[model samples]
Target: MREIDRLEDELSPLPESITRIRKLISTLELCHHKAERWVTNIIEAIGEGDTAKGLGTRTAGELHPAERDWRDACVALSAWCAGQPAASVEIKIGGRSASCLLSKLGERSALKEWQVQRLIERIREFIGWPRSMHHGDSVYVFMEECGADFEPPGDAECPEHYREHEEFWKQTMQTRIHDTVNGEAADFSLAVAIDVMFPCNWNFVGNLDIVLGAIGGELYAAQPLTVCARNICHVPIRERMQTVCRTLQCSLQNQRSENDVDSTLLELLGDVTAPQRWLVASLDKTIRLQLRL
Candidate 1:
């Protein structure tokens, strides 16, 4: 028999089970679509920021023309894709265990938390969110793997340091992301797109144009999520946050979930750094990533 036929025969007796699986698959599909919309909105937001910088800068939260365009596009696309089914998986990336749903998958199964982690380790990659980088029940975070002596460039108080270390940050981040996802095209697609759209100069290297093209790679490499949320839920937070930092650095701002922020705040309470006290008052709405139904 053909491979498809053979699998059909194996699956034929489990119609009811298949039906249930199909239903759950449908739910996953919907979630994936939602994730896509979420990511697209995020990207446009970044694009607008860039455009605004060119037009004359604006502070975070102050909407600019480009920003509006991005948000609007995201809203419109989200509306159109509403109710459509997508796929989702819970995987460990960076140092946190979180779920990601996507529009499609090629052949491989969506990884479980541990499996995702193992793969990530094998590849030696890093993304915006570090693997196992969990703060609480829901917040996930990560940062680049800068060495111990990697002193951040900037003023003591205001820090002109960003300019000084910008190149190094980008290069290191690029290596982390690329090294991790090189073999897993589908996973890489989702991740790379998010990376570019968010444009964390703190992690990526090379020219802006190269960074932008990474989005296309993700768009085309898009795949279905095969893993379920339940498979990833039980992973321990400390293990998840292994490489996680108390401070959510530059590129990670775009991906912060509400829970992640709360967790970070809690982590700050225990940290003895001089910056810890300032965080108590720095809680802003923009720092929160709101979840949508």
Candidate 2:
């Protein structure tokens, strides 16, 4: 009944599963509430970031909690909605609700391993954890098409170079995509939309506020994520990192015990440029020395 009453009425501790179920309920409700408020904010403030007027209208100031709750909630919900019962595919956003750098590259894209690593870095940058919205996850990650495209800022290290590309980076950084979600590629732009679940293997969890606009864009967007190379992850950070370690030939294991690994740490291993790659190697060497100790 009432929250206080429920707390007071408890004769004994509830079963762990029940407690988790209650938590799941709370999380989903929170997700719904947050999403609603988020929508409300967008509606009230039509022009925020580098939007095309009322188009990419998300504002930059609002705080977006890590998507972990939604990710965990969806995973648990997926199970409940399935097996014991089943979650019918109520709705889906086929494509265009996502963004990709490699897909855009098709042919020019470098090694497949490089492409995969680049995407993994992007995931680590935006999504903070692993096993998000695992299978039955119920959190909705939204996408803004913003006409044909946009990418995060270049963030060149050189003071002069950074200044050179600074202006262009702003224009390019808008239109955040649910990096892992396979939103449809558009010949023409589509309106903003969101969807959280499908019968897919696993869903992307951490688009964060970082993924979306230049106009009403987020504060985090200005920073670069190593996963983003310069793109998202469901397969896993450790598993993927193991592969990257081999491909790139650097020792990068034990990065948070199979977690998404923090983006700040990931920045050290970034491959954004030839210099960035060199920095990753240098940093990895230093980290390895510490690891052996």
Best by lDDT: 2
**How well is each residue in 1-293 modelled by candidate 2, as lDDT tens digits?**
24334442452354443333233223221112242332222212211211122212448433344344333333332332233222322322222222221122223212322222223333333333353434333222222222212321234222342244444322333334332222333211111211122111122222222222211223223333212111122222324334333333321332433344334334333333332233233323322232221
Point out the worst 10-residue segment of candidate 1 by lDDT: 284-293
In model 1, which runs have C-alpha deviations exceeding 4 angstroms? 1-62, 84-188, 199-293
lDDT of 1 by residue, 107-206 (tens): 2332212222222322222221223223242221222222222222222121242244444334333431131222343222222223223211211112
How do the predictions measure up, each by TM-score? 0.18, 0.20
What is the overall TM-score of model 1 with all chains considered together?
Answer: 0.18
Candidate 2 residue-wise lDDT at 58? 48
In angstroms, the error of model 2 at 29 is 10
